[model samples]
Every structure is written in C-alpha cells, then in structure tokens.
Target: MRITELIDRTTLFDRILLVFLLFVTGASIVLIPLYLPHGGQIRIEVNNKLLYKLPINEDKTIPIGGLTVEIKAGKVRVADSDCPGKICVKQGWIDSGAIICLPNRVVITVEGTAAAPKGVDATT
Candidate 1:
C-alpha cells in the first residue's frame, strides 16, 4: 500500500506513542552530554605497552622511542617523530582522540570523557 494510506490507518494511540518516542529521543540528545564527564588525562603507549599517563591540564614535552610528544593547554600531539610520512606530527593539537604512529609503534590517546573541541566532531 501507499505510505499515506498506512499513515492514515494509524490510531490516536499510535500517534501518541510516536510522539512520546520522538520526545524521548530529543531529550536524550540534549540532556545526556550535560550529565557525562568531560576532560581528564592522556595515555601514551608504545608497542602496545603503557608508557605514560599524564594529566591533560599540564604542559610538557616527552620523548619516547624517537617520538616527541607535547602536551599543552589541555591538548596533546606528536610534535616530532623520526618515522616517515609524519602523519602523526601533521595531526597537530587535539584535546581528545589519539595520535597513532604505526611505523614507530606509538599510540597516544585521551582518556575519560571523549568530548571534542567546540565546532569539531571528529578529527582525521
């Protein structure tokens, strides 16, 4: 049957149920972020092994396995790396998510609430 015909067959109870579900979904989208935790620490790993856990608020530069990691102003990035392609270095500063240098076997990830920066959804 046509979509309009099916919609016309819906009862008042069905309409009410649909509205309730839409309301619940909208409420969830709005309220959930307010209740969730945000911003914490960053974890650095090498060769699948934990290397360092540092607070995101602190600013420092760390050298591990020929990669230079810099954490400043609540963000962390690979300032420099010996690996080719330099993909990790090009990633720049990030308040959330990770910088993975596969050639160097390094992984840096932001832990806790995975909130992205304002106006940014997900970084490449």
Candidate 2:
C-alpha cells in the first residue's frame, strides 16, 4: 500500500512540475521583450517582399504574408496571422518585434529610430 501511494504521489508531482514548467516558459517568452526598448522605425520583409516602412510616431498597420500587423507607440506586433497557433498575433505589439511564418516564408520585425544616423540625409 505504501509503495502504491508513493507511485501515485510521484505521478502527481510530475504532472504538477510539467504544468509549472510550461507556465514559466510561456511567461518568459512574453515578458522578455517588454523590458527591451523597441522604439524606432520598422522594416518588414516577407519572402523578400518589402511590406512596409513605418516611423515611430503614432499607431500604424501593415500587411505581410497576407497578415495584418498593428503598431502603436513603437510596439510592432501582428494583428493577424495566416498560420496556425497565432503565436505571432498573440505576441502583441513589439517595438523591435519579430515573427516568423515558415509556411509563408515571411519575417516581420521592428527597426530603426526616428533619428537618422549622423551625416545621413534621409531626404536623399
């Protein structure tokens, strides 16, 4: 009887541990980006296609791989996704954000700041 009880507890412990690990991993993935500053202009390319170039002034949106991305306050995130899981969409807005859709061979990311590099004329 004691051996059976021990086995049952071990199984329960394993299940609990699995749940905890999953939660920790998921939280880390979401929270990690928030701490980093993502302010800047953005360049998105999908399958070598130039999707959009946006400045970090106000909210903006774009389409990549047939998906729509919404940006606000320097956060670049997928508002829609063609692929399953929708992890990219769930990732919310990211200021230096990136999402990969392997099926569509697409990648979206935020980059660049409002200020151009020294000696560089953006008007050119």
Candidate 3:
C-alpha cells in the first residue's frame, strides 16, 4: 500500500475506525486473559466440599450474570459482579490463578503448571 494513497483515503470515519481498532487491539492483548482466566477450570467448592469443575482459560471469560471477571495467571476477581458486593467485582482484575466468591459459592482457580503471581487472593 502506497503511503500517499493511504493518506488520500483518510476520512473522519476512517480515522475513527482506525483509531478504535488500534485501541481495541492493544487493549485486547491485556484484557483477553483476564476475562477468561487460564485455569482450564470453573470449580465450585462448598464449605471445603468439591462441587463441580469446568474446563476454561483466560480467554474463556467466566461470566457471573451481570458481573464480568477476568482471570489471570494467579487469581481471578470480578471484572464485573452482578452481586451487591462489587467488592469481589471491583478487586481490579487479579490472577494468582485463583478466584473465589464466598457469597455466591463461586470459585475460579487457575491451575495448569503456569506461573503464579507473588500475592493474589480472590477473597480479598
């Protein structure tokens, strides 16, 4: 593609689209992992009792109804939580590879021989 030709076709919409796409691409690189944690799992443990498990990852983006969570390499937190706490929801995206919600009885812990962060806790 010729630089001059590319410049010539540049319109407001084109510029906007280009900028938007760039922002999206850049953000996706970082955000993709959080929305879907790399644990290969969606486990539910009730009072130390194993409830259930599902295969998932950082790209899977476990959704808790109105809440959105981004799983990282260590712990998972509520990227968005439908529940009232928003506390778990607003923990600002973590991934010591483990995320758990005491209230909802929801637990997400990442485990795949992957690296874990120094200090990550889903409960906090």
lDDT of 1: 0.86
Poorly placed runs, candidate 3 (over 4 Å): 1-58, 72-75, 112-124
Q: How many clashes does the backbone of model 2 have? A: 2
Global fold similarity of model 2 (TM-score):
0.56
Per-residue lDDT of 36-106 in model 3, one digit per residue for the tens? 54444556454566654544444445566455665555445567666666566655654434566667766
- Superposed by TM-score, candidate 1 places the C-alpha of residue 48 at a distance from the truth, in angstroms, of 0.3
Candidates 1 and 2 compared: the better one by TM-score is 1
Prediction-by-prediction clash tally: 0, 2, 22
Candidate 3 — worst ten consecutive residues by lDDT sum? 51-60
Put down candidate 1 lDDT per residue, 86-118, tens digits, no spaces: 999999998766789999999988877444466
TM-score of each: 0.60, 0.56, 0.37
Candidate 3 TM-score, true structure as reference = 0.37
Cα displacement (Å) at residue 78, model 3: 1.8
Indicate which candidate wins on TM-score: 1
| lDDT, candidates in the order shown | 0.86, 0.72, 0.60
